[model samples]
Target: MNDIDDFAQAYVLHRRPFRETSALVALWVENLGLVRAVIKGVAGQSKSAILRNAWLQPFQLIRVQIRGTRDLKTIYKFEPVPTGVVIKGEPLFACTYINELLLFTLNKHEPELHFFSYYQEFLKRITDIFRPDTEIEPALRQKQMIIELRCFEQYLLEAIGYSFDWGSARDENIEVNMAYGFEPGEGFFPQASGLYQGALLIAIAQGQWQTKGALGAARAALRQQLEWVLGRSLHAPSSQGKLMRPENG
Candidate 1:
């Protein structure tokens, strides 16, 4: 059993007020997966209160020391990661959507270092999209953002053992330009009335995003796959309007 006295690198996924002077936080730690902890005295007028207030926001990377024996641990310290990425606009809502997914998908106490790294890289890519030095056109930028979200969703599903093969194992001569239907628990099958284009399925299987309509195809495919894993529709109410708006319009 890992001791609660040690400090771990983590990112805040979500937080809410627990009582009058404390708050409950969900943290995605480097080696400990998602943890729910109680931050004591954060709402009080103590000297460390201001620091806690600044460091406890969602998506801020921090090093924390927690102590407790029960399911809910008590945070002892907060050390913010310098040079942490700051997100705004549509990316901010996208971040929230991913956070909600993590909260719902991850099991407490299971260490998923690969998924943790995938999350870090995902944030880095989102930050890069908004960088002043980058010169992406507005339409392409929106498409790239959607691609990033879909890629992360795929990674998340695979990490938790819910991944389905994107290619048909029985068909070795499958054409990359034909239409195919995706059956849950089975791979893609060639069909004249299939909903997904062969080029799109191939692109998703290979993680290629340079082709036209790749992003839109990935969005539809991932949405269906994620819905199957979640057993319900994946709804991001806060960003539904913005997400549904056409990128090229």
Candidate 2:
């Protein structure tokens, strides 16, 4: 176990009060996958007022100085990276959902720069959607956000090595017109009750979300795949689950 004293970019995934004057924080670092650290004296009167501020909020990009060994680190410095992005209402719930996914999916001390970049892009897209100058109808905006969430979920799976190929399945080419069932830890196979459409799978593979019913299809497919990969169903409590539900959106 080596001590790391360098600064790195990170986003707060979750935080909870520890003792009386400190907090335990889960941070997603650029080169470090997921890091758990204790921020000393943030909850009480201390000089590290920056840690007590909104900069520690989830999805707020920031640079942090981490110290100590692999099991648990201590955050000595926290600085905000402002993007002027504000997430509220349904979008906020969507953010929470993604954060939960990361908390469950990522492991400690692993480096995943690609996943980090995708996460940054996801936040930027959210910021763009809610920008004051952009004109988008409520219904349309909601649809777009859902698609965005699906896209992010797909990328997250890929990053963690749970990706599925849409063009080919188990070393065989997928017929564009055929319906197939998805087998976890294996590729697709033809089945009468298969829930995935070839064209829809292709669209998801190609990152195309504008097609009719594509959003719903992507959501269902990804959720099924993720549950299989994680070995448990995603339990998003009724409230957060409703935000990501296509029918509710």
Candidate 3:
């Protein structure tokens, strides 16, 4: 690829210590899809002086300029976006999930600005709900996480160009309430018994979170679909499973 000078807004997805005093950063860039670049001598550098402010944190928007290398690029400058300082904790984690998915699945240099915007909006919503001093109501937290995850999943599938039959998959008027299965190409389907509720599928596809119960059911179902498609080699972050696990309390 020719050297291109471009200013891209990106979300830091993952970063690893690079060759002697550098870091290899994976980013989901606006209009550029995913790009992996190396930030030279980022560690031990003052956050006030460099791109350290956005290092390894998810849900942060940054303007990045990079010079392409064979494996990774020389990231010239990464400045935190105007909206960067406000996100933290659970909102951060939710963005991390989005980052992780892009890091593992998206092809580099592909443009996906719309999906990136939706991902950003999802994180923005969660950040707005978070109150550090107050104990998070379990019911509310659960509802929020489920809604956000559903949105993420839908965006992912759509970004990858998968267009499943949402109408048939979520047809509530059907007489048979039987257990259904999802193929990689075909969405939910009634083979023997469509036990999967059509309404839940519709709710998830529509991004509707009207009821906690409906959201919870959609969460469980969508999780299964994403996992199966991602396959065993693509492991979810260890923290992601914890966020989804049921609490005894």
Candidate 4:
């Protein structure tokens, strides 16, 4: 246990006041999926930059070193990922939303490295948009962002042991042409009759661009199921299960 302590990385996910001068923080480290640590005297200490308003933005990877304590551990050291890029605008906020979800849903000291890595990669993809020379058009960029977000949502649902099947129904080996609603236990079913739609599944399987409308419809179906699975811990409750709106202009 002592040796393993030296290998942990530091991450600052969320923080709140623990007392008048101290703060409790949620950190996601490489070795530890989520850790609750207290920043002693953060509100009152002049040298508490690491606690008050440090560089621990979500999605920006950092290397952390911590020493375990009887109560709250000490954050020994930390630094930004050398190759990290700053994400701007609504995307950045969306990233924060994801971090909040992880912090809220995950158990402390639990090692969910796969989910952490998925988050790291997602951040990298968004950071690409901030690159100086990328020439992706604004409309195309929005489309790409939506597609990526949808994919991430699916990934999150699956990773958390939720059942979500996008399979479509078909007759005579031909695609089933209809929209379906997603249910937590029942999967995807036709709009009114609770029947499965095979054609939508086929379209998703084929990765056809024409299926954007279908995919959008399917996403709406899944939202209902996901909401139940996510429960009351959903972030940005005012958004109410809707995808964060893309920036205009």
- Return the lDDT, model 2, position 22: 76
Lowest lDDT sum, 10 consecutive residues, model 2, at: 238-247
Q: Stretches of candidate 2 above 4 Å error?
A: 45-51, 108-111, 236-249
Return whichever of 2 and 3 wins on lDDT: 2
- True-structure Cα RMSD, model 2: 3.3
lDDT of 1: 0.72
Predictions in order: lDDT? 0.72, 0.74, 0.60, 0.58
Model 4: per-residue Cα lDDT over 78-142, one tens digit each: 56665565678746666655565555456422434577677777878877865666687665775
- In terms of TM-score, which candidate is strongest? 2
lDDT of 2 at 7: 70
Residue ranges of candidate 1 with Cα displaced over 4 Å: 44-47, 108-111, 169-173, 236-249
Residue-wise C-alpha lDDT for candidate 2, range 42-71, written one tens digit per residue: 665565654555678888888888888767
Task: Choose 3 or 4, whichever is better by TM-score.
Answer: 3
Q: Which residue pairs does candidate 2 place in steric collision? A: none
Supply the global lDDT for candidate 4.
0.58
lDDT of 2: 0.74
Clash tally for model 1: 0
TM, every model: 0.84, 0.86, 0.75, 0.74
